[model samples]
Target: MSALPRLSTIFLAAITTLVAVLLYSPLFVPIVSSFFTISHGNVDWSSPTLSTYVTLAENHDILAALRTTLIVGVCTVILSVVSGTLLALYYHGRRSGRSILQFIIFLPFLMPPIISGLALLIFFREIGLERSLLTVVIGHTVFVLAIVYRTVLMRLQSMSRTLVEASYDLGATGWQTFWRIILPNLSSAMVGGAILAFALSFDETMITILVTGTQSTLPVRLWAMMRLGFSPDINALVALILMFTVLLCVLAARFLIPRQVATERT
Candidate 1:
């Protein structure tokens, strides 16, 4: 490569590293502080301990909120993966009306969260549905449906149809073909979609704040505590949540990278 191109690459790399540090500074601070003592709004680097995690464990309210977050995440994952997969499979081919319907399905995710949340809130109230964890799950599923749908749909599109034809030529029933051939091929996409849905639900705040009732998810609970300033345990919670989210991403990558990428590349 020319010197100019090499220099440009180095400059771009430096800028990217700087941006990454700036973006992750908040996350880094909390994680580092989680292992240390905090006093008078400053982290004490002298004493490193797991006391904050212990405090986090003893915090009933935070624990309940975390439980609620997990519950919402799991429900949202299940609903999103199933609905998204079905939609992807059903609409894999183009039809005039299907494009409009797919657009509507993605509207919640395409719009701002505030708008989506307000719309859902009003719709729920108009239908005599109360704000609760179920509402939160619905809101999260709606918000994340676009991501899941797109992921599964792309996988479906990239899939070769020869397998299906061969299955039928072998005298397999529709259900058998779907169960044995299609489902296995789409499994990784479903897993990836589920992970993305759960991650979104785990960290969701604005929609959860609007549509949730008395019981709040972890993000909402953390938002509520902002006025009082968070304790050291909040740092512990952040560190843990960050770790868990990273783990989910790793698993998703593992599932989707092998056969899924091959399908797309082909």
Candidate 2:
């Protein structure tokens, strides 16, 4: 029995390590290569330099794409959070058709990205809507909205009704109770959803490609550059984006975990 347990632990540990490597190797390759140069198609691992980072700064085309991505991310975050929160709030107290309506709202997220992209492309054409950054933002929001909505709705459902009842017993108005009691508790959930939405928006490519007109986000721009071959500075850009994405994930964990623990303890 002891040998069996020990062997299982070893197996699990090995599998975990293998999975981590498989997941992160692609990310690490670009980050590691950003500080080194290639000679005759071989990376010069013996020497590392900041030349790639410097060149990345001066690359106007990539910089513009990065800026566009940021703009789209911020806009997507705002639109997703507001719409999601409102929908979550609306559904929470309603007795009718919430499940059906939620299914409709989540269709974009639940369907394959290719399907969603093609559907949106057709919808835009039917409406005579020209593709642009606006369309990109719309696509991102649609894709990420279900995540934000579910996050907020889950938090709302988990909240104790006693808190709101107590606020009402103290003669607080509906708006006052929400502002002071409910919104405060939902704040962490909202923030986590926003971070997730922003991350998805930043990395979105398939939907953006179908919706965008000429001006492209970073991922779309990178895809186009692939045909012409990548610049060395692209490695540096990938490194920076990886670091930023990790930071956002860390921040989201920080905001979300404590609230979950508190709720569990309560």
Candidate 3:
């Protein structure tokens, strides 16, 4: 029995390590290549330099796409957070058609990105809305809305009802209780949801490709560039984006985990 357990542990550890390497190796390559020069399909490891990053700064096309991506991401985050919070608040503890409304809100997110993008594209065309950054923003917001709504709704569900009752008992008005007792409790979840929405918007490619007119976001631009072979600056850009994504993930985890733990305890 002891030998069997030891063998299973070793097998699981090996499988975990293999999976980790497979998942991260592609990301690691760009980060490593960002600091070194690749010569005729070989990396020159002798001299590392920051020239690629400098070149990335000077790449106007890439920078423009990056700017568009940021704009879209910010818009998506703002729209999704506000709309999602409102929807969550409206549907919370409501039994009338709540399940159907929740399903509708989540439909886009649950669909494959390509399918969702295609559906949005068709809808826009039917409505005579031209492809543009606004369309991209709208698509991203629809896709990420469920995430924000679910986050806020979970937080609300976890929150103790006594907080609101106590506020009312203390002679606080409805608006006052919401502003003080509710909003304060929900702030962390909202922040975390915003971070997640931004991250998803930043990385979104298929929908952006379908919805964008003259301007493309970073992921779409990178996809176009891949056919021509990647410039060193592209590698640098990927590395920077990976770092930014990691930071956002860390921030989201920080904001969300403590509240969840506290909720579980209470």
Off by over 4 Å in 1: 1-4, 259-266
Distance from true location, Cα of 119 in model 3, Å = 1.5
- Model 3, which residues run further than 4 Å from truth? 1-4, 259-266
What clash count goes with each model? 0, 0, 0
Tens-digit lDDT track for model 1 on 1-266? Answer: 46578879999999999999999898888899999998887778888999999998998999999899999999999999999988888887556688787898899988999999999999999999999999999999999998899888877887888989999999999999999999988899889889988888899899999999999899888877776876788888889999999999888777767664667688
Q: Candidate 1 overall Cα lDDT vs. reference?
A: 0.89
Return the TM-score for candidate 2, rounded to 2 decimals: 0.94
In candidate 1, the residue pairs with backbone N, CA or C atoms under 3 Å apart (3 or more residues apart, or in different chains) clash, namely none
lDDT score for candidate 2 against the true structure: 0.90
Greater-lDDT candidate between 1 and 3: 3
**In terms of lDDT, which candidate is strongest?**
3
In terms of lDDT, the poorest run of 10 residues in model 3 is 255-264
Q: Per-residue CA lDDT of candidate 3, range 1-266, in tens?
A: 56678879899889999999999998999999999988888999999999999998888998999999999999999999999999999988687998899899999999999999999999999999999999999999999999999999999998888989999999999999999999988999999999999999999998889888999999998898887886888899889989999999999988877756677697
lDDT (Cα, tens digit) per residue for candidate 2, span 1-266? 46678879899889999999999899999999999997788999898999999988887888999999999999999999999999999999899998898999899998999899999999999999999889889999999999999999998998888999999999999999999998988899999999988988998899999989988888888888777997888888889988988988888777666656577787
- lDDT, candidate 3, at 261: 65
